[model samples]
Target: MCRWLVYAGSAIRPEELLYKVDHSLIDQSMHSKLGATTLNGDGFGMGWYDGPRPPGLFRGIGPAWGDRNLRELSEHLESPLFFAHIRASTGSPVQESNCHPFRYRDWLWMHNGEIHGFHQIKRELVLAIEPELFPHLEGSTDSELMFYLALSYGLRDDPIAGVARMVGHVERVAAAHDIRDPMQMTIATSDGEHVWVFRYSTQHQSRSLFYSRRIEALRELYPDNANFRRLSEQTRIIVSEPLGDLPGAWHEVPESACGLVDPGRDFLQDFHPEPV
Candidate 1:
């Protein structure tokens, strides 16, 4: 599994989220306390939306902590929405194409888990993708394939439902191959505006996921903190784990839940697989 985070709120340098926090994403890449792997040094990537243009991506086939390019870019680039992921390869090659935060036009996606026995169902899953979209598939990781699958099922129309449909298809095919517990994922997808995050697994014990508490409340608690003061009240972050140690700073996303972070609201609802 990998570790990732999505930030949707006021435009700010990516470093504010990637490096400023106590247990920042960079820190997690080195010594993750809750991730499946303590060292996610296989690779790293970031995707951010600037204006009306398609989201920009910066992926590297090296540890995030030591990448000077990643450090420089994070300090300079600013966007209202962004995704950062540090990978720990399960079986895929450690190359730029296999990195997280895969993009399609205006959308960006990252995942922190895998589809069990993907090789057993790869052919069927790949064939299910819309032909036009299939040509755009550029990576071999199950994470990227999952992103394209969501797009094929209408992610552009309804992200939550589209992802649910994708999951359903993978599980359906896995079951046909006599595989049990076919899926495990903590996924984040954004269309340059709203961000949708999902946590689910066939075994019902998904990976860790948490979202920050409302910024206003954090401000009230730490009035003197410059970090909280700089952030807008609408800021919401969905991360693989808590970025800081502040009490009430993070809330665990429920098992089998879909979390939506829109303009000024964040909410959760039950998530169930649905056939496309």
Candidate 2:
């Protein structure tokens, strides 16, 4: 239902992907090729790690394509690891607080897709969040609630398992309410260093997710491409959709999969939801 991207590796201006690319995130906000909706103009957000400070965040309740501040900030803000999301509300109100790339302490998170019948199941899921975390729930979107649910299940300690538990917990509640196939998500979260991504849903048809091929390999394919010149061999991007159609440059993540992208190495593995 939305478009987003995460970058890890060498520090670079976000505009390179948000505005400069052929089908950039900004472009996708209005002309999404893979998302369920064509217009992701409800709101937008950006989160990035800069130095030792907590990650910087900027969110706005406006079309990303026309946001003057988003455009201006993207041009100057450079980060080794960053996340950008443009939203198309499933049912949540269009508000700044509902925009993605949600932050908690040093962590940042964003999501695409929704929990079917979220309104019917919201109260139950919200009640399950850790009492302390419940106060930090700043938005009404299912995505933010999912973030806290994962944290309640232990995201700060074990991100993958925490999210798995969160998903499992949600499905359990949904089943009680007679809402079948309640989960659909492609999520990305980071803690100023490593980034973790997941693609999964109860119905087995998750949304699009792709990662950039190794910069070393990309260089071999496009020696004259200046974009690859500065990126480190480990530089990786996990996106809702491809930034361009460069052959061998993008690889679709398998269904029900989870992966990690760090400064060292990146890998993907099968993912499944288990009982909490």
Candidate 3:
């Protein structure tokens, strides 16, 4: 449904992740090799944090590959954590508010899949959101709705458990409507500190997802590679696909798994379908 990239590590300009690579996220906006669509030109957005709270975000209803403003902004904005998403609107309108990398308080989120039967299931899902949070929803997107659903289920404290519970609710409700496999999601969320990513679908086959190997290991593997040399040891990235063709540099996240990049730990764990 979309193409996205998440970067967390040493402070650096966003272009290093969004545009510099041979097959960067911006490139994917025009020629995505692994997404449902090769050209995700509906819209694009970027979010970055350099403070105590969540990051600042810039979004527009323009294709990522040809946006002069995005190119200009990425060159100057630097942060230790950031997210970029190129959209291929499955149901939502291609408007600024409907762009990916939605935000709330000190948190940012983006998704690369759809809520099947969203139009039919939208009411039930919306009614489940916390009233306070519901009022804050600025867009009519299944992705943004999913974010608030996680928040209502306690995302601010325990993202993993909260998201699982939210998914559980979706499954239960969708079943009532005779909707099978109601979800396909590759989501990334962060609070300017710890970042969590999930890859799951009700049918057990989800979209593509990968995370980069540690920068140190990459440096050793390609000692003469300037790209790997410029990165910090903790530099990490999770994407809808490998950013480049560097062999052994990326690993596919298992289906029904969650990847976490905390301040000190970077690892993934199998995700069970049951409510957590």
Candidate 4:
């Protein structure tokens, strides 16, 4: 599994989330305490949405903590919504193209889990992607392939439903190949407007995924904390783990669920897979 974070709300420097927190995304890349692995140095990538523009992406093929370019960019780039991920490869090669926050047009996606026995079902899954979208496939990692599968199933119109279909498709294909416990995922996907995250797996025990408590709530819980003062009411950070140990600053997203951090109120709802 990998580690990832999604920031939606005010336009702020990426470094605040990527480097300034207690267990910042960059810090997690090197010393993760709750991930499947402690070191997620295979690669890293970030994609952010700015006003009225297509998202911008920066990916590198090494430890995120040591990437000078990643650090430099994080310090200067600010956006209202962004995704940052540090990867730990399951079986894929460590190439830049295989980095998370994979892009297609205005959308950005990243995931922290894998499709069990991907090699066995890769051909069928790849062939299922829409013809127009399949040509855009650029890497061999199941993570990227999964993103395209969701898109193929209408992710641009509805995130949760599209993903449900994608997961359903994967499980059906895996079952046909007799692969048990066929998938595990904690995913984030966006089209520069709405950010949707899902935590699900065939085994019902997905992974560590959490969203921040409302800033208003955090302000009351930690009255003197300056970090809470700067955020807008809509500001929400969806991370793989808590960045700090603040008592009520973070809430674990329930297993087999989906979260949407929107421009208005956010939502946490049950997610169930459906046939594609």
Candidate 5:
């Protein structure tokens, strides 16, 4: 299990959400309330789009709380869309490459759950990735594998459907191996434009995921709060937990649901895996 957040809205320094919030991602790394593991100190990573080019990434094989570079970068860099993740390895190695916010071309992705019995299905899943995409696989974590799997299934064309196919493939293979509960994930992906998030599991109990309420409403409630005023009305954030204790500031994403955040509107709908 892990903790992660996706911010898709106004351009602001990452620290505003990664550190300034009461229950920020950095805080969750040391004291997560809903994750399977409380301390996600294995590693951390962030990906953000600053221009028309591909997203820039910063990853480290160290606890996010004590990483001075992460702290400095977060305070200086600003982006309209970004992702940050703190890892609590399920079984993968604690290395820089295994960090989340995996990237390819202009896309970025991260996850907060695992592929149940990953060791049993690793070979099969790896073989399923397309040959061209296989060479780009940079880490052994199931999270990165899921990213490539989605890419092979057309992530660049239709992200939601590609991920659905990826999950379907994993579930089908796990079923053949007689693994009862084969998947658990709260995943986020983006290509510098629309952001898509999915919460699902084969057992019907997925990891925690929440999206922030409309910034306009929050600003009205806290008129004097500079943080709310700094953000634009279209600002949208999805995280593993609420960033603050403010009532109605966050909404838990429903089980087996997919959330899409575009320019000025956000949409939530049922998500079901489709076999490849």
Candidate 6:
């Protein structure tokens, strides 16, 4: 399992979400309160859109807190949309290529749970990826494979539909091998503007995911809170857990749900289970 966050809405430094909160993503890497593992020190990665040419990515096979390069880049880069991930490798090697927030063209993706029994279904999943996109495969983690699967299913054209189909494909294959809970995931994917996040599991239980309340609502809840004061109304975040403990600041995404966050609008709806 891993911990990750997607920040969008306001064009601000990625560090605002990666480091400013009391329990920032960097903090979670070392002291996560809700993850299966408190210390996600295997590796870390951050991706953010700047001007053009997809997004800038910085990854290291080091603890997030101890990575100076990550600190310098996060403090300097500003993007309306960004993704940060702290890894706790399940079965993959703890290398830079195995870090989260893998990218392809202008798209970026990250996941927080495992494809249950990945070792058993790895071959089938690999064979299912789009042959053209297969050449882009550069890592061995299940997370990276899942990204290619979504791309194969049409991520560039219809992310939601493509992901839904990818999960369905996984379900169909995993079931053939008698694997239960073929997936457990809280995934985020983006194309530099819109972000689609999903929280789902084959077993009806998934990792925690929460979205920040609208900035206005948060301001109302804590009128004097400096953090809320600094954020724009469009500022939104989807995380593996809340960054802070402010009341009325965060809401849990329901089990088997997908959250879509555009510039000024955000929506969360039920996610139908995918058959494997």
The lDDT for every candidate, in the order shown, is 0.92, 0.93, 0.90, 0.92, 0.93, 0.89
Cα error, candidate 2, residue 92 (Å): 0.5
lDDT of 6 by residue, 64-154 (tens): 9998888888888778788999999997999889998899999999999998899998998999998899999999998999999989888
Q: Summarize candidate 3's per-residue lDDT along 1-276 as a digit string, tens digits.
A: 899989988888999878888898988989999999999999999999998865798999989888999999999978889999999999678899999899998999999999999899899899999998988899999999999999999899999888998898888888999998999999999988889999999999999999998888998899999877877888889999998789999999999999789766777898765553
Displacement of residue 149 (Cα, Å) in model 5 is 0.7
For model 2, residues 65-145, the per-residue Cα lDDT tens digits are 998999899999788989999999998899989999999999999999999999998998999899988889998999999
Model 4, 162-221: lDDT tens digits are: 999999999999999999998899999998888899999999989899999888998999
TM-score each candidate: 0.98, 0.98, 0.97, 0.98, 0.98, 0.97
What pairs collide in candidate 5? none
lDDT of candidate model 2 versus the reference: 0.93
What is the Å distance of residue 165 in model 6 from its true position?
A: 0.7
**Backbone collisions counted per model:** 0, 0, 0, 0, 0, 3
Q: Over the stretch 105-180, how does candidate 1's per-residue lDDT look in tens digits? A: 9999999999999998999999999999999999899999999999999899999889999999999999999999
Error of 6 at 53 (Å): 2.9
Sliding window of 10 residues with minimal summed lDDT for model 4: 241-250
Query: Which whole-number lDDT from 0 to 100 does residue 8 have in model 4?
Result: 90
Q: Which pairs clash inside model 1? A: none
What RMSD, rounded to one decimal, does every model reach? 0.9, 0.8, 1.1, 0.8, 0.8, 1.3
Model 3 residue 130 lDDT? 90
Clashes of 2: 0
